[model samples]
Structures are given as C-alpha cells and as structure tokens.
Target: MNIVVCMKQVPDTTEVKIDPVTGTLIREGIPSIINPDDKSGLEAALVLKERVGAKVTVLSMGPPQADLALREALAMGADEAVLLSDRAFGGADTWATSTTIAAALRKLGFDLIICGRQAIDGDTAQVGPQIAEHLSLPQVSYVSELELAGDSVVVKRTFEDGYQRIKVKLPCLLTTLKDMNSPRYMSVAGIFDAYKKDVQVWGLADIVVDEANIGLKGSPTRVKKSFTKGAKSAGKVYEVDPKEGARIIVEALKEKFVI
Candidate 1:
C-alpha cells in the first residue's frame, strides 16, 4: 500500500497573533511546530507502513518555512516528502486547501490519505471532509484504530459519547485522533538522514492549480477581527475552618453579586 500523510505547521498557541490591519494571523517571527494532532496521523501512517510494509509519503502545503514540518516527518520514517509552497497558496481557507491537496493527491495516486482530525490553529475540522468531497472518496474522521482488509479499510472512530466502527473502500481518506497512537521520537540516524535528504517542492503552477480558487483571492470567509483574550485573574484565597469556610464563601459570593 502507498500511504500519504498530510501535515500542517501551526503557530505556537501562546504566541499566536493577528495583524491589526488584515485581520489575519500574524505568523512572522512566531514559533511553529507540527500540529499536535497531526503527529498522531503521522504515527498512524508509520504504523501502517510497519504492518504491511507500505511506502509512506508525507505531504504539506504552506510557505517555504513549512519544510521544517516535512523534514520532521521524514525523520519519523516517511519514505518521501513533498512540500507545496507558492505565494498563490497563501491565505487559503480550508475549502481551497482541501481542493489543492486533493489535486496533489490525485497526481500522487495513493491508496490511502491520512490527516489529523483538526489543525490546532484553525480547529474547524473541515479540511478532511472537504478533501474527501473534492476527491470523491469515502472518509472516516476521528479514527482511533485502522486496519487494512482485502480491498477495504476498517476504522474505529471515537466520539464524545462512544465509538463506532466503519468500513471504507481502498483509496479512502482518514483523519486520525490523538489517542490513535503515541508518536515515535526521531531516531539519531533518522535525524541525520532527514538533514541530508532533499524534499520535492511543488509550486502552484507545477500542480496546475486553478488560480481563481486558491490563495487569498479564493477565500470566501473573512475574519472581521482577531484579538487575544486577556489573561484571567487568580481569585483570592480565604483560609478558614471547613464549616466556617462554606459560610464565609457564601457571604463573599453575595457581596460580589455572584449569588
């Protein structure tokens, strides 16, 4: 099996900022890391490779700097890595991102596509389903377990309340949850290999991407504004006897108009 895993680089949540004028994420100088959830997806891909000795390809789309995430994937044992980088891909919403990624996957001709359940920065949970729709393939999101059957894949999906089992044909897409597996740390040898290796970079023109539906030009949703929430205050502590504490807290609550 040929497995393709999609990953994203996200701003460190604590340092994320927004451009006052554009109302978009101000990514300049912000520390970046692979989306936490995508690490699980990467681990799932490696597990599949171990199970069936499949070839794994890691794919990511972002600015040139996103090569960092791809290199990390390679260090985690992916066979090949591709970076889709172009100014035309800038400011792409999940819909446009899914479209572009789907087109690239079509060119790749893979048996399976794996992704994280959601990107940490966006947390919209739209890209996986959107990619499935664009590629016209079945998709299972929030998958905790995956097994390859004859010409099909079995998935165990997790939900807030419970889990569900589902079967999908080959050439399907899967969005993995964090509980799927623990991501393996990069080996010393793998780290050296990643540094020496070269990743294939594809631009918007190389992918024959439609200019009208990509980048800032194609995005429909607009962020009117974005601002960080102010830090919360630590409440005052009162020390008292257990019985007296309850009575005192009740009086304080009423005094504070919180009753």
Candidate 2:
C-alpha cells in the first residue's frame, strides 16, 4: 500500500509570543516542531508500514525552512518526503492550500492519506476535509483508532459523547487525533540517514493547478485584524461553611445569569 501523510511545521505554542505592534505571531527565534496531531498521524502510517509492508511518504507545504520538518519525518521512518514550496503559494487560506495540495496529491498518487485534525497555529480544522472535497474522496475525521481490512480500513471515530466505528474503502482520507498513537523518537542512525536523504521539492509550475486558484489571489478570506487574548482577572475565593458556600455559589451563578 502507498500511504501519504500530510505533515506541518508549527511553532511550539507553549513558547509562542505575539507581536504587540503588529498583532501577529513572533516567529523569529522560536523553535518549530511537527504539529502534534500530524505527528500522531505519521506514527499511524509508520505502524501500517511495519505491519503491511507499506511505503510511506510525508508531504508538506511551507517556506524553505520547512525542509527541516520533512527531514524529521524521514528520521521517523518515512520512506520518502516531498515539500511544496513557492512564493506563489504565499498567503493562502485553507481553500487555496487544499487546492494546491490536492493537485500535488494527484501527481504523487496514494492509496491512503492521513492528516491532522487541526493545526495549532490556525486551529481551523478545515484543510483536511477541504482536500478530500477537492479530490472527491471519502474522508473520516477525528479517527482515534485505525485497522486495515481486506481492501478497506476500519476506524474508530471519536466524539465528545462517544465514538463510532466506521469502515471505509481504499483511496480514502482520514484526519487523526493526537491521542491516536504515541510517536516514536528518531534514533542516532535514523537522524544521520535523514540528513543524507534528499527531499523532493515542487513549486507551482510543477503541479497541474490553475494559477488563479492558488496563493493569496485565490483566498476567499482575509485577515482584517489580529490580536492576542487579554489577561483575565483573578476569581474571588471564600472560606465558609458548606451551607454558606452553597448560597454564595448560587448567588454568584444567578448574578452571572448562568443559572
């Protein structure tokens, strides 16, 4: 089986900072890591590769620096890596991004595609489904468990209340949750081998997509403003008997119109 995993390099949110003047992320000097959910998806693909003798490829779209991210995937046991990078792909929204990725996927071909549920930077959770829509492929999101059947895949889809088991045929897309699997670490040998391997890079002209349907020109949404969340005030605390505490809590709820 040919498995393709969509991965992204995102700033570590715990270390992220906002620019007060520009209202944008302060990316300079910040460390970047694979998106957690995407890493889990890669782990899932690696597991399948080991079990069924599948060939795994990692795909990503970002700036030139994103090559580092692809190398990390190679170090994690992906057989190959491809990076889609171009000035023409700048300032793209989820729709344009998916269009470009889907076009590339068509050229690369795949029996299965795995993506993260959402990106930490955007938190939109829209790109994966958008890619499926563009490719006209069946997709299941929030997959917590995955197993291969005869020519089909069985997955456990997670929900807030519970989970549902689903069976989908081959050539389908799946968006995985971070809890799906624990990602393996890169070994010394793998790391050295990863640096030696070449990452195939493709630009806009390489894929068969309309120029008008990519980059900022094709994006339907624009950021009018950006800002960071404000700090919240501390909550009030009280030490009292159970009965008094109950009354105070009820009164507070009523005051806040939450009761």
Candidate 3:
C-alpha cells in the first residue's frame, strides 16, 4: 500500500507572538516545527508502513523553511518527501491550499491520504475534508485508531460523547487526531540519511494547476482584519458588609436574568 501524509510547518505556539502594528501573527524569529496532530497522522502512516510494507510519502506546502519539516518526516521513516513552495502559493485560504495539495496528490497518486484533524495556526480543520472533495474520495475525520482489514480498512472515529468504528475501502482520506498514535523519534542514522535523501520541490509550473485555482485569486475568503482581544476589565470591588455584598450580588444577578 502507498500512503500519503500531509504535514505542515507551524510556528511554535508557545513562542508565537502578535505584531502590534499589523495585528497578525509575528512569525519572524519564531521556531517552526511540524504541526502536532500532523505528527500523529505521520505516526499512523508509519505504523501501517511497518506492519503492511506500505510506502509513506510526506507532503507539505510552505516557504523554503518548510524543508526542515520534510527532513524530519524523512527521519521518521517516510519513503519520500515533497515540498510545494512558491510565491504564487502564498496567502492561500483553506480552499486554495487544499486544491493545490490535491493537485499534487493527483500527480503522486495514493492508496490512502492522511492529514491532521486541524492546523494549529489556522484551526480551520477544513483542508482535509476539502482535499477529499477535490479528489472525489470518501473521507473520515477525527480518526483515532485504524487497522487494516484485508482489502479494506477499519477506523475508530471520535464523536461528541464517544467514538464509532467505520470500515472504508481503499483510496480514501482520513483526518487524524493526536490520539491516533505516538510519533517516533529520529535516530542518528535517520537524520544523516534524511539529508542524503532527495526532497522534490514543486511550484505552479511543476504541477498541472489551473491559474484560477491557486493562491489568493482562487480563494474567496479574505481577512478583513485581525486583532487580539482586549484584556478583561477588573470587577467592581465593593466596600460593604458581607450581607450587603451578598444582597448586591443577588440583585445584579436578578437584573441580568441569571436567576
């Protein structure tokens, strides 16, 4: 089986900062790492690879710095890696992003495609399902467990209160959560080999992408404005007897219909 895993290079959340002037995330100087849930997705693919002799390919789209994430994937045992980078691919919304990725997948081919449930920075959780739509393939989201069943695959998906088991045929997409599996560590040899391995870089010219279906022009969504929420105001402090304070609280609650 051949598996395709979509990974992303995201700013480390803990160190992420907001630019006061632009009201946007300040990615400059922030360390970038593989999205956590995407790591989970990668782990799932790697597990299948070890068990069933599957070949895993890691795909990511970002600036040139994203090559680091691809290298990490290679160290984690992915058979191949591809980085889609170009100025034309910048400022892409989920729709355009997924479209570009789907185009790449069309070129590479796949028996199964796995992606993280959501990206931390975007938190849209739309790309995986959108890619499925673009590829015209069946999709299962929030998958926490998976197992091979002959020609088909079985998955356990998370829901509101619990999870349900689902069986789907090959050539399907699954968006995995962090509960899927633990990511493996990179070994010394793996790290060295990662540098030796070739990572294919593609741009608009490399893929058969329609000019109207990539980057900002193809994206209908626009960011009108972005800003951080103001800090909460301090509550009123009453200097009165305990009983009087209780009475005031009750009266305020009643006025607000909290009673």
Candidate 4:
C-alpha cells in the first residue's frame, strides 16, 4: 500500500511571540517543529508501514525551510519526502492550500492519505476535509484508532463523549489526533541515511492547478487584524462558609448573566 502523510512545519508555540506594531507572529528567531498532530499521524503511517510493508511518503507545503521538516520525516522511517514550495503559494488560506495539496496528491497517487486534525498556526481544522472534498474521497476525522482490513480500514472516530468505529474502504483520507500514537525519534543511522536521500521539491508548475484557485487570489478568507490578548483582572477572593460561598457564586454568576 502507498500511504501519503500530509505534514506541516509550525512555530513552536511556547517560543512564539506577537509583533506589537504589526499584530502578527514574530517568526524571526522562533524555532519550527512538525505540527504535533501531524507528527502523530506520521507515526501512525510508519506503524502501518512496518506492519503491512507499505511505502510511506511525507508531503509538506510551505517555504523552502519546510524541507527540514520533510528530512525529519525521512529520519523517522518515511520511504520518501516531497516539498511543495513556491512564491505563488504564499498567503494561501485553507481552501487554496487544500486545492494545491490535492493537486499534488493526484500526481503522487495513494491508497491512503493521513493528515492532522488541524494545524497549530491555523486552528481552522479545515484543510484535510477540504482536500478530501477536492478529490471527492471519503474521509474520517479525529481518528483515535485504526486497523487495516482487506481492501478497507476499520477506524475509531473520536468525539468528546465517546467514539464510533467504522469500516471504510481504501483510497480514503484520515485526519488523526495527536493522541493516536507516540511519535518515534530519529536514530543515528536514520539521520545519516536521511541526509543521503533526496527530497523532491515541486513548484506550481509541477502540479496541475488553476492560477485563480491558488495563493491569495483563490483564498476567500482574510485576516482583518491580529493582536495579543490583554491581561485579565484578578479574581475576587472571599472567606466564607461552603453554603455561603455557593450562594455568593450563584449571585455572582447571575450578576454576570452567566447562569
């Protein structure tokens, strides 16, 4: 089987800072890592590869620096890696981004596609499902568990309250959760071999996409503004009996129209 994992490089949230003047992310000195959920998805793919002898390919769309993320995927046991980079792809929103990635997936061909539920930078959680829609493929999101069956896969789709197990046929897409699997680390030999392998870089010309349906032109959503959160006021503290405290809390909620 050929498994394609869509990965992304995102700034480490802990190290992220906001630009006070521009109201945008300060990425100059911030380090980047593979999106945590995507890393787990990659681990899931690698596990399936080991169990069923499948070929795993990691794909990412971003600036050229994204190649580093792909190289890390190789070091974690992916058979191949592809980086989609181009100036034309800049400023793409979820729709345009999914369109471009779906185009590349068509070229690569795959029996299965894996993606994180959402990206850290953009928490819309729309790209994976959008890609499935673009390709007219069945998709299951928030997959917590999966097992390969003949010509199909049994997956457990998670929910806040519980989960549902469904058997879906091959050629489907799955958006995985970070808790699905523990990611493996890059070993010394794997790291050495990763450097030896070539990471294929493709631009807009390499994939088939409409000029109007990619980049900022195709993006329907725009960020009007961005800013850091303001400091919150301290909470009120009161010393009272349990019954009195409950009454006070209820009264406070009523005053705030929260209840």
The candidate scoring highest on TM-score is 4
Write the residue-wise lDDT of candidate 4 on 1-259 in tens digits.
Answer: 9999999999988888877677677889899999998999999999998899899999999999999999999999999999999999999999999999999999999999999999898787899999999999999999989889999999999999999999999999999999988999998999999999999999999999998999999999987876778647898999999999999999999999999
Error of 3 at 182 (Å): 1.6
lDDT of each: 0.88, 0.94, 0.93, 0.94
What TM-score does prediction 2 earn?
0.93
Candidate 2: worst-modelled 10 consecutive residues by lDDT? 224-233
- lDDT by residue for model 2 (1-259), tens: 9999998999988898888677678888899999999999999999999998899999999999999999999999998999999999999999999999999999999999999999998899999999999999999999999999989999999999999999999999999999988999997889999999999999998999999999999899998976678757898999999999999999999999999
Q: Whole-model lDDT for model 4 versus the true structure?
A: 0.94
Q: For candidate 1, lDDT tens digit of each residue in 103-123? A: 889888799999899988889
Ranking by TM-score: 4, 2, 3, 1
User: By TM-score, is 3 or 4 better?
Assistant: 4
Distance from true location, Cα of 164 in model 1, Å: 0.6
Per-candidate TM-score against the hidden true structure? 0.85, 0.93, 0.91, 0.94
Clashing pairs in 1: none
lDDT score, candidate 1: 0.88
